[model samples]
Target chain A: MAVYTEVTDEALAEFLTHYNIGSMVAFRGIAEGVENSNYALKTTQGDFILTLYEKRVDPADLPWFLGLMEHLAAHGLSCPLPVRARDGKNLNPLAGKIAAITTFLPGVWPRRVLVEHCEPLGAALARLHLTGEGFAPKRANALGPDAWNDLLQKSAPQADSVQAGLGRELDSMLHGIVANWPRGLPSGHIHADLFPDNVFFLDGEISGLIDFYFACTDIYAYDIAICLNAWCFEKDFSFNVTKSRALLRGYMAHRALSEAETAALPVLAQGAAMRFLLTRLYDWLNTPPGAMVTPKDPLDYYRRLRFHNAAKGAAAYGL
Target chain B: MAVYTEVTDEALAEFLTHYNIGSMVAFRGIAEGVENSNYALKTTQGDFILTLYEKRVDPADLPWFLGLMEHLAAHGLSCPLPVRARDGKNLNPLAGKIAAITTFLPGVWPRRVLVEHCEPLGAALARLHLTGEGFAPKRANALGPDAWNDLLQKSAPQADSVQAGLGRELDSMLHGIVANWPRGLPSGHIHADLFPDNVFFLDGEISGLIDFYFACTDIYAYDIAICLNAWCFEKDFSFNVTKSRALLRGYMAHRALSEAETAALPVLAQGAAMRFLLTRLYDWLNTPPGAMVTPKDPLDYYRRLRFHNAAKGAAAYGL
Candidate 1:
């Protein structure tokens, strides 16, 4: 839960004069994301989300994120449509930060992931990958394989401060992954951070997908690997085979996996686990004392990575 | 920003089964208040606020706070009405804590208070006191004059540690206030914590008053004093006479102040400042290291207390 910047009502009123959305009736800072300051805004016309991009988000990547949401919404995938201003620009400036308003979507992300949740998530994810076929903008995943070594270098010095011998273990795992990293396997736009909290559900069906800040061109199978790590694990980090079967089968119903994509699942899943592990490790080490946001335990992903390392093939994923 | 307890989707679904409000659509924890976990809940029926009372709130006083809102809303004062379930109860247990749903009020609280804000605030506050004339339930102000000595005792030891001789100054001030505290100034239900953030505005009008947890039967003049301390002070701690005059005039337009009330304004304002100073000092000293909520500077109220100490009479408050 984060609201790093406070926007005054006078400044907000002045900002709204540029838009066609009528006067602001209400606006509330939403305690949801860590990367941006978000407000639930209601106006004379309709309800929307006002997002102020914080320093953590690159200003250069703002257009890609906004454009991806617009493209996906236009292609019939449920997501926030950026509320364009009279100047035909969705992104504008407020309180010395880039800000944009988007149409409010109505659905809650599933808190306790059930088997029922995995199927629709799988189907919507496939649709997202398919609909994002020709999006004009391109964003390379900043946290992709090429970035892992630098992240590990920064986190390695103090990695064992959190756990004994953890740094050496991570170094060995990184060496193995770099040696066997998959290449040239069906690249497309992927929601690089498709965690359970980013997917919304209504009436037991997937209502929408959000937080496209991490969307970038990557191996589509890697996106699936992220979901398998996110949705198919229990609180105790135990793998749920039934849920995995449902998620994979549901995805197959929309887009069949190539044999190469199938063979790549275990390594992709391992890499996905490694990706989150390194980032979480970095955050855990760097978060200042008494920071507003709490960092997730890096060991949670370490546990997931261990599970993926032992898997034989897609068969181990219940494919 | 506080959301101490996370309510799972399954628990929320079960909690909603008791209410007539249709299936849940969306809910996000709001980053606004300090007392409880508040969520902006949307359903098929309409928008509402779902509050889960944290340990800071006394469980015994839940009914009083909820009932006061119901009473005030029913009596034509703009406020959030507690929504009763099919069981005819507004308060119920959810996630092992007491929770309730209230009708959502549509307006943003003023981020920066203006002189124009004070008049409507004064008039609405008077209306609130008038409408609360015959409220069936009565809750004593736990932070009233009687509680000041105890609060001082708890906070006094560390007071001088914060500033040289501050504890002795507070001790003398407490002695004078205890001896001269006003009585019989037309008491009624008061929104004791009417900070700018607690009042909502739309179209330059006071749309609603919220946060009734601090509402109690107290001297009506003291509530005005609290407002003077809150709304009529500039960031540099100087009094704004124009805003105070407009506020006082607006209140008189609704209900005239008696001679005794007018005479007691200076001492009452001093006590009001002392009340906040003691509590804030206690919180400042006792707040756990690395706690999420930052305690407000006790010295801010100490500055207000000094200003009120030098005030001559009602004229000092722009009467």
Candidate 2:
């Protein structure tokens, strides 16, 4: 629900002149992506998305993201491929912000997660990891375990305002999760923020995975752990074991997990839960009172972390 | 930036089963109109817009609005024609709210209105007034002269908070406007909210007019007056007589104004300015802080109102 930068028609017409992707016929600011401004664009060539990287996005990292998507789509994964201009560049300036056009993936993200959606989502995550393996450029996972301490500390002062003693619980929980974060477990580029809202589904199949701003070099199992926390939980924060099993089975169908990766599932999932909890907690405490976006409840992830902290092994996830 | 209703994929799929517009392939909430939740929908058959009526829109008035669009489009006006479902009904329940599908109009609204945009805008508006000659159903202009007093009173207490002596000025102006409001000019269905944002242009031609939720039976000249205020004013509130001349001349090309309508133009424009100023004043005073849509500055219209009040008839507008 964010369109911070307003693109004037004249500015847009001039901007489109650099591209060879036909002429702009229709464009609209879409209520998608919070990190940047996104416009669903239709040209004589095809439908696409025009993303203006806002202040929130570091312009330096865009090449890595665009290149990764190009590589993934080239390797048979369904994702947005950045359209190149006549100068053979994918990234350029539009209305004082860096912007890129990517092929529009046609599908709607599920508002309500169904059991039928989990397995296909798992498969897509695995496909992304496998296809993105050889991408030359590397991006450090900015929200990795190393960053959680600072985030939690920033959110600590007013955390209990959300719920009394909640900050203390998070302070204790984050330390344990970070220390126990499994090291040396199948690392590669992973879509670190593979939430349900970022995956589009068509006819019970995963049509495309989007919002690759969070993609980074990270543990493959950690990505799976993110999926577990994101897709396998009911609204009440109850873990749906059936969904978890289906997700894992779907993942294993592509790339069978290492024995160590399998055994470390609970800790990895705990780390994943902690990662979301800290970020959501920060947003909940800091986003301006009247902002259009309703920040996710940090406490929702807190309950998921508690479940992950109690899990026995991969068996707990029905893996 | 408003998406009040979150339509689930399951619910949408079920909803589309009643329509003959092919299966849905893509849908995204677009940041377009402020009155209703709008989604840009691409189906196998063609692209369209899905509008879910929110509480801001009176459900009882939907039939008249939808019918007007259908009638106008059928009469060769470039507008969104409501798509009838298999049951021969255009409106139906979706996600617990009434929703309808309409033809997706291509073309972007001029973000910064140019002189070239005014004449076409004027001509299209007259075409709308001319073509809507025989529309059976009539809708009252809810913000017409009779309603200005209550709106002014509601906003009066807080008006000075926005500007010194503003409340007193507006209170004094409202009475003068109400008493001198014109009796009868050419009357028909008018696009009450035909601001630049509601009109789309393609290749310097008017492609379509949209957001007819505010469409109501009113004086045709009053609608033209709205355009004079909306299109001919510079961002700094200075009236561009060159643009106004082009606009009035364009209207004259389509349907020549009667001598009475021409002489009444200044007061009609004055009434139009007051209509917007009162509503904007009310919204400015009433909209809770942190709301998504910024209430437009009431003073912008106040400045326009002052100009219109002093205008020496149609000659002042270059007619």
Candidate 3:
């Protein structure tokens, strides 16, 4: 629920001159996504999404994000392709920030997670990984395990302020996970943040995958591990085994997991949980006064991490 | 930049059962308008705006607002027409709040108001008045002069806090205007808040007039007064006589103003300014802690009120 920047009508009209898209007909800021300002634009050509990258997004990484979307869309993944400007570049300058327009995908992200959503999401994840094989540009998973130490250091000072001794507990967990972190068996570009909100569904099927800001080259099985934590958790913090099995089986239907990938699931899942937990904790502690966004509770991931800790192996995740 | 209510996928799906607009293709909360939760909705039928009435808007006034849009659109005014459901009701309930879908109008609101925009706006406003002559449900101008006393009472306590002696100045102005408030100046349904943001433009022509939540029976010239304060003011708070003349001429081309209406212009404009000033002042003082909205500067209206006070007559506005 963020549109941090306002693009004036004159600015938008001038910006559109760089594109081959028809004259702008309508545009309204979209109240979704926190990292950038998004507007649903309608032109004589068609409907598209105009994204103005905010400060949180590095301008340098935009080409990678835009290129990845272009490659994936071309390879038959249902996702938005960045619209190339008249100069043959998808990334362009507008309103003092890097901005780009992408073809608008039509579908609503599922609000109520169901078993039906899990399978399609798993299949789409595999497809995206497969389709992303030949993308020329690459970005490292910035929130991966290697970066967890810095996040922990930043969040450590105020962690217990959220809950008593929460800082100590997280510190202990981080050390254990870092010490035993697995060498990934499979690695490629993965949608590091494939939360339900980023997956669109229509008529009980996954229609598109979106929000590739966090997409990066990472352990592919670790990507599955992230989903296991993200999609397989319930509102009361209970594990939904049926949904886990559905997601894993759905992924296996497309790309079978090697034995090493399967064996590494628990440790990978713990690392994934730690990744989100630390980031959320940092945001929870550092959200500026009067921010429109509600910082997600880091404790949610703490609970998920506990579940992953208790689970023995990939069998526990129905892999 | 407001979407106060969160409409879940399940609730939206259930709500659509009442409509015959085909299956929902996409829905994104629109980051526009301050008083309601608006979603840019697309379905198998076409694009539309789905609004969930927030607490700021009176639930009782929903019928009049919806009916006014229906009447004006049917009478050939380019505005959003309320879409009737399968049961033929323009107003319905969803997510425990009053909600309805209206056909989406395509155009961008003029961010930089120009003289060209003023003419079409004036003409369209006059047509809205003419076409609204027979609207069945009547809504009184809730923010008219009669309501100013209560608003002043609520805001007067903190008035001087915003500016030195501002409270005393507004108090003096309110008394004079209330004593000499114009009477019987050819009243009818008027778009009371026809701000530039509500008027959409495409290709240098007015495409539609929208945000009819404030439509009510008021002196038609008072609507012009509101526009004069809204559209004829530059960023530096100076009046633009050229735009004002264009607006008056455009309105007269459609529906001529009576001599009495013209004579009442200065006082009506002053009253219009006071109405906004008081309401804005109240909002400024009463906006809850941590509320997402940024309260508008009450002094903007106070500055306009000073302009209206200095004007000798309608001629000062190029009428």
Per candidate, native contacts kept equal: 0.66, 0.74, 0.58
Instruction: Name the TM-score of candidate 1.
Output: 0.96
| Residue range A1-319, candidate 3, lDDT tens digits | 7788877788999999999999999998888887889999999998999999998888888888888888889888989999999989888888788899999998998777888888888888888888888886678888888888888988888888998998889888888998988784778899998988788888888888889998899889889988988899999999998999999888988988889888888999999999988888898888764576767888999999999999898888876
Interface RMSD for each of the candidates: 1.5, 1.9, 1.8
Q: What lDDT would each prediction earn against the true structure? A: 0.91, 0.89, 0.88
Q: What lDDT is reached at residue A154 by model 3?
A: 89
Docking class of 3: medium
Q: Which 10 consecutive residues of model 2 chain B have the lowest summed lDDT?
A: B287-296
lDDT of 3 at B265: 90
Candidate 1 residues B53-74, lDDT tens each? 9988999999999888898899
Alpha carbon lDDT at A279, candidate 3: 84
lDDT of 2 by residue, B18-136 (tens): 99999989999998777789999999998999999998899999999999999999999999999999999999999899999999998999989999998898899999998998788
Runs with alpha carbons beyond 4 Å of true place in candidate 3: B159-161
- In the range A240-283, model 1's lDDT, one tens digit per residue, is 98999999988888989999999999999999999999999999
Sorted by TM-score, highest first, which candidate order results? 2, 1, 3
What global local distance difference test value does model 2 have? 0.89
RMSDs, each prediction? 1.9, 1.8, 2.2
